[model samples]
Target: MRTVARVIAELLVTFGLVLALLVAHLKWGTDDYTRRAQRGLSDELDKVWSAQSVVAVKPGRAHAVTPPAPAPAKGRPFAVLRVPRFGASWHFTAVEGVTDADLAKGPGHYPGTAQPGQVGNAVFSGHRTTYLAPFNRMGELVPGDEILVDTATLTHVYRVTGHRIVLPTDLSVLAPVPGRPGERARRASLTLTTCHPKYSAAYRLVVFAELSASRPRTT
Candidate 1:
């Protein structure tokens, strides 16, 4: 009886240590790696923008600028996203691909989707409760909130239009017109996607926005 009691106590202690380590990894280790990746991506974007002599427009001013002739290559850092509602310093580098590795770094742009400021849907996906929780507060966004996408040559501003919760297999939410498959795109739009219900991946939470204004980025 004494030996059995000691074994049980040891097992419980082992389990407790394992659980604590898992929580620490999720809380600190993942966030630290993600922050390092985000900082590296931001510096890469700065280098890309610095090579060009772009024009600048005053805030709230809408200007016409041509989108990049060709889309960025897969896994490349193309733009930075800023959500005013998140906070003044809250921003993330948006990479070109939406693969697991790409998203592990930060919010990633969906492949084949329209580029920012283009005449189609620009889709971005991020982790909701892990890897720095880039979109952890995505549900807090409401209509009229501003989302800014800064590229090498221009800054595209979009206003939140609506949001929806859909199944993981619902590809329509990623359509050119969002939720409308087979429809051609007529205007520039932005879509932010993240896992639903905070920590689960059983569903997707999508936030839709449309281009409100765009400005040139001054060199």
Candidate 2:
């Protein structure tokens, strides 16, 4: 009986070690595949130059900024964002947060931030290296990407200006225009966000882009 008890104890210990390893792998091992998928999407966006992605803007019933409205046909509402020189483009759904669950379906839109083509700052969030990392190559994006926000009603275009890495505590990057608040709303901007420090969240990656043009939907 004592020998059987000892064997059971050893088996339990082995199971515990295996469980721990599985958890760690889930947290980090999938990054390589995720990065490849992300880079592939960026490459495809670089090739496409003239696709009509439409973005429609309306008062959000929810208090969150840029809350996603349903697509006209009940499918996912996708918007095309173009950055020409950077060779970056992706279809993002305006859901909130960048969690694993949120990213599995699409890029999560930062809540309480302005929607694209709105009077304030529109912030979008995505994972950098896992869970279908749409923004993994975010650091590669350069100035002059034609950021196109498309909805069911219209398409809005913006140009990348610059980027900054700020502490998570420093959320001023989400503020309208990053410093000016009293000026009359004249333009729209896109702020893309992700975890900074490459593989960690020691800081926040922020990409700032400004509106350049707009096209109304004909349909």
Candidate 3:
């Protein structure tokens, strides 16, 4: 009986160690992968923006600049999101779609909504507890904080207006005039959504902001 008891104790200890390792791997592995993806996306954006600087000079010397490329395809990155309140290094590449696979790379832009700097709301979503928890501190955002979206052509600056928690089924929050279904949008806005309360998807935490300024990006 003494030997049997000793064996059981050893087994339990082994199980505990294995569990700890698994948890650590999941937490650290996801963070590492997200950082790698962010770097790659940043590099890609540099190339994209560089390509947008093509210039054609007429015989008389009138130069015409080529327009920026269209938005990237679904699941591809199109912009970089930055919130000053999140810290100096707080930024993420926002992909075009919010699919599970796309989000694993970083925050994702919701389909069918206004693109950044457009007349309507531009919506984005990110994980709260996984995939580096890109929006882990989203709840910390408060009114008047600055949120910036940088595209190849322009930098759209938005100021946080408010935040709220809502059920996952609340599609109204994705409207052209967020939280107001069937209403005409009079202003450009930004909405960021993430799983609420940390480590749980029981609700969605949304941060709303309005475009405060937009400026052309100097090469």
Candidate 4:
């Protein structure tokens, strides 16, 4: 009896140690990823600004115009985002045609969607758990909170209008081409989605926001 009780206590101690290690790893890993993401975002933003040009509109006003040719789709549409309600802000990084390692560092886009301010829906994705979950609090977005997308040409701001909870099979919710048979065609918008119900992927949490305004970035 004594031997059996001692073995059980040892097992419990081992489990506790493992749990502590996991907690520490998650905390430290999140911080490290956050710093790495910030640096990458900043560098990308600088590159975008340097490559873009603005067209003069009026006194103290200028509008971004597409360069005679596109900016080489190598980076991303937006430069930075400001989400005050959720306390989330970061420069947009292009994960298109990049590895999962690149995507894990920051928000990534679903290829083939409209880039920011392109007169169509732009869909972006990020993880709900692990490696600095930037969209973890995405469900808390309120109407009128700013969602900025900075491209080489312009910086666009979006005002979150609504959100929805849908099943995993609801791919129609992401139609960038628009003109669905039954659903109303939403205007130029942004949709953010993640695994719903917390800690699970059974459903999706989606937030929708509409383009509010756009301005040129003054370098």
Model 4: per-residue Cα lDDT over 135-158, one tens digit each? 778887888878887666567888
Candidate 4 global TM-score: 0.77
Which pairs of residues collide in model 4? Answer: 78-150, 79-150
TM-score, candidate number 1: 0.90
Residue-level lDDT of model 1, residues 24-73, one tens digit each, is 99878889999999999889878776654445577988554444445677
lDDT for each residue of candidate 2 in 1-74, tens digit (9 for 90 to 100):
99999999999999999999976675566655554444554444333222333345568743213344542221
Error of 4 at 6 (Å): 1.7
CA lDDT scores, all candidates in order? 0.89, 0.64, 0.90, 0.68
- Lowest lDDT 10-residue stretch of candidate 4: 69-78
> What are the clash counts of all predictions, listed in order?
0, 11, 0, 2
Q: Rank the candidates by lDDT, best first.
A: 3, 1, 4, 2
In model 4, where do residues sit more than 4 Å from their true spots? Answer: 54-78, 87-94, 97-99, 177-186
Better-scoring candidate (lDDT), 3 or 4: 3
lDDT, candidate 3, residue 69?
A: 74
- Cα error, candidate 4, residue 16 (Å): 2.3
Instruction: Compute each candidate's TM-score over C-alphas.
Output: 0.90, 0.61, 0.90, 0.77
TM-score of 3: 0.90
What does candidate 3's lDDT look like per residue over 1-219, in tens digits? 999999999999999999999888768988888889988888887887778767787887866486857867887778889888878788898899998889989999999999999999999999998789899999888899999999887899999999999999999999999989999999999999999889789999999999999998554
**Candidate achieving higher TM-score, 1 or 4:** 1
| Runs in model 1 lying further than 4 Å from the true structure | 54-70
